[model samples]
Target: MSRTIPRTALLAALSLVTAAGATATVFGTSAGAATAGCKVEYQITNQWNNGFGANVIVTNTGDPVASWNVEWSYANGQQVTQGWNAAITQSGAAVSAKSLSYNGSLATGGSTSFGFNGSHDGTNAVPATFKLNGVTCNGATDPTTPPTTPPTTPPTTPPPTGGRADNPYAGAKVYVNPEWSAKAAAEPGGTRVSNQPTGVWLDRTAAIAGVNGGMGLRAHLDAALAQKGSGELVVQLVIYNLPGRDCSALASNGELGPTDIDKYKTQYIDPIAAILADPKYAGLRIVNTVELDSLPNLVTNVSGRPTATPNCDVMKANGNYVKGVGYALNKLGSIANVYNYLDAGHHGWLGWDDNFGASAEILKQAATAEGSTVANVQGFIVNTANFSALKEDHFSIDDSVGGTSVRQSKWVDWNRYTDELSYAQAMRTKLASLGFDSHIGMLIDTSRNGWGGAARPTAAGPLTTVDTYVNGGRYDRRIHLGNWCNQAGAGLGERPQAAPAAGIDAYVWMKPPGESDGASKEIPNNEGKGFDRMCDPTYTGNVRNGNSMSGALPNSPLAGQWFSAQFQELMKNAYPAL
Candidate 1:
């Protein structure tokens, strides 16, 4: 499993040192060119306990720069935990940010910006120096705003990676994916453009946070280690934000274009694998949910669902989705100490004939996509962030009891599986036949499916509606079973636990409950980004025969921001009761 990646592949990946421990700044050798036309501004946009976010805009006050690099230092012992947009790295107290290929060129008097989420001690002081292309800005001063410290809990030191092999995960500790929770924690709640007050519910959003593709993983790893004190650490990384991301969905659309598979490989996957291969993190157990919703959509509804797979037709037009995810599995699947769980759509989805075995077979193709065998794979993840029950206490995959027509029948779908557990076992069997290891396990997301209490039956009736009958015990009664916004009446599912069933390895909270699924279709956001129709209360796309309607879940913040009202609702309706 530890075979060397080709030299051509390792060339760039091996040199991507995106993070370094620095308490003090170490100046690097500068090219002696005079940089008179460059100017930069750093502003702290939002702050929370022990952390803050900053946006930096670079202006070419003079001539156009074919390329650019910005460097700064954090005084007062503040560490740049993680960042996005620009490729950021820290050495000692010094930090350097280079523009991505997309942001490298700036016309004269033009401006481009990048943002980052970072942490600081109680005393936050802006850097006194700024340099673009290694030349210092002339009239820059330290920011005057006082530093703030949000409420924080000290992290327990993470125990050795994976713990004892025989007792892997015996520490009973679930690692939070800080990659996301940290972002949600920073969202402002009041009625503001970036404010999403309900984000408080995601205080522990990531027992392990996912770091998306191409944003660089080194900084995230550094942040995770810093956040983990002296306890067992289980880190969850969601390898998402793919080019042509959310193929059909627009609300959670990603930055990379679908055609950029080359970038996805060299820039995204390679660098990600490099960071995870670090010797320092060898003792940390990492759970990698590879490309959430990427492959599954292509298998189930790429051409059919309008509300769910909005841009899928364009994606299918080009072959980026296939090449992109395949390369990801080939590279990341075989890493050491990394548990790669490929995302499989929830039960209701694969439960349909058009999906099941086809999805399983797709998983097989992806496992061996890049010259690697299925042995490169770990296992499969079912119901990732989707509101599907672990098991419908009322129905079975083979249950043929009720409903008028086959379309309205809950237990008459492909091979008759209605719950996540049965689907998972069946998938494991299918996967084994595809050459996966016998020990291959499945992860069921218990995040939002906890409709156990009153909402269990969720008014999903009228008997004629096959969806309602099949999903009778489900808390999610959205227009289409594919509705994935911040669902209404959703309660916390089973607490994070390992081995809940025969083929199921763990019940993880893959989706932080309070985070928004898409912007409220009501509010307007920035360009190249749009509100998910599913979040619109008035959305009517996923409905069938006026019976099922998509968008049952209301307006939400951007994909991962906190939703206050949703949090309250989740708490009010927690299943096992937190």
Candidate 2:
């Protein structure tokens, strides 16, 4: 399934049983015409030193709260550092949390919850007052403060493994979405996995990605840990939700604003890091794919994205992109088992001079932000949620053809590179020049690079379509690299493997092949589901609707969910005969 959507239906079940062991503090219900049937329950999910993690479920017992807003005040000088599923603001002792766009409409008698990470002095007490809209609760309970402070032990940050034996992952283990797997199994041409895959996806789209996703991630880890025998447990997480995210596309927009860098760190990364850092999970190896479109949009921003908050420009100006990623790498990297890979745009992106050096500089800056060098990072990823061909089969970096000396083409730079393989090789060298260690390798998302069958390009030369020319295929399958939905004619690339090429560590199906990119236009279910017009077949044009998609897939499920047609097509067209 696409990494864009969360399995929300499983959120509640997952959250209730996560490793943090939450404690729900119930409040007395107020009954009156003026009160609005509002009752809130506060749960302290986790605490350590001066910081704490919490969950708040606000219940509307009386009437529907369309576009609801919840306001509360801190009692003992505790301040909310970051929050999710709620837009929280704190002024001294008072804190107010407004409902996010996705969770504002809570039905009567129904409840929705939000989560956060906060800090306090020696005394941290839960607030006694809560107001839904403007009405105060009848009998709200307050939490007690601890009398004594305990010394906090600093967690160990392991040095990078110098030998192959010290590496946590013996081989690359690709995560499979259990929910998507089941959906695929139920399809017409079903295939159920005999052994459960090692990784699981945690989405951070809108407010839902944080609130409901925690439980899902916990459950996935719990299950994987339970069955893990001699093999190391691997979990793949997508750190996707960024402000102005996918600015170039409409289907996978995020809830955050470009400038909310502090919030992004506190609200988004903290909670996820907390889960990973839990002592119980220390035995497992976790691979975090940080911020998919963050760096990439910046690359595109340098050319063509002449907007005020060109996704990358805004992130750079506010320093959120680097800061957020740095915080994640440092916080999660501090955990010996957790591996962080920053998203380096696909080969198609970094292939040009306009894009190359800039991406490497960003990587260096991020390392600086994390208070470390590039060598500390696990590596960078390419072709994430993209359909760029894995390798340029017939052409080398110096091959000359098609009116330009490979140097003048939009796909090649003056540096004499023409394909993704060359791009990654050159990318490794650039990063090394900037202080990345020689051992630092590259990873490719071999999920859907297999653009084969009738649409696979057969003939070469004078190939105007950049994808076909680079891919060594005559009929390029994707509408554009920007076309991220359930693409037509695109198939699964190579399965997970170690050391696919020199300087390349692994080939992974990072984007699960069969999952729908999003719902198609002319079909609708939920907000941001099915029918973005970008996925509409009738609208023949570039992903932004200016050119034609050569072999586009039909409208399908919500992004991240399964689409039977897309799955079958992928298996049918898989490269290396999956």
Error of 1 at 367 (Å): 1.5
**lDDT of candidate 2 over 1-578, digit per residue (tens):** 21211324223333444223433233334455643667765655445566766666677766787876777777678878665567788898877888766568877766666656677685555555677776676552323221111111122223454422223334333333444443443343433221123234455534323233333566556544533334444667777765556555656656666776667677777777787888888767777787776665555564454332454565656676677677777877777677777788766555657667877888778776846555458777777877767765655556555554555434343544544566777787888888876667777787777766655655564466443465454233454544556777777776666565777766666676566676675554443322456666666664332255524576576776656688788777777554
TM-score of each: 0.62, 0.63
Cα lDDT of all candidates, in order? 0.59, 0.60
lDDT over C-alpha atoms for residue 482 of model 1: 56
Residue-wise lDDT of candidate 1 within 231-334, one digit each (tens)? 44556667775678776567766667778778777866777777788888876667777777767676655655543454676676676776676777778756
**C-alpha RMSD between model 1 and the true structure:** 14.7
Would you give me the overall lDDT of model 1?
0.59
Error of 1 at 186 (Å): 11
By summed lDDT, which 10 consecutive residues of candidate 1 come out lowest?
A: 196-205
Name the best candidate (by TM-score): 2
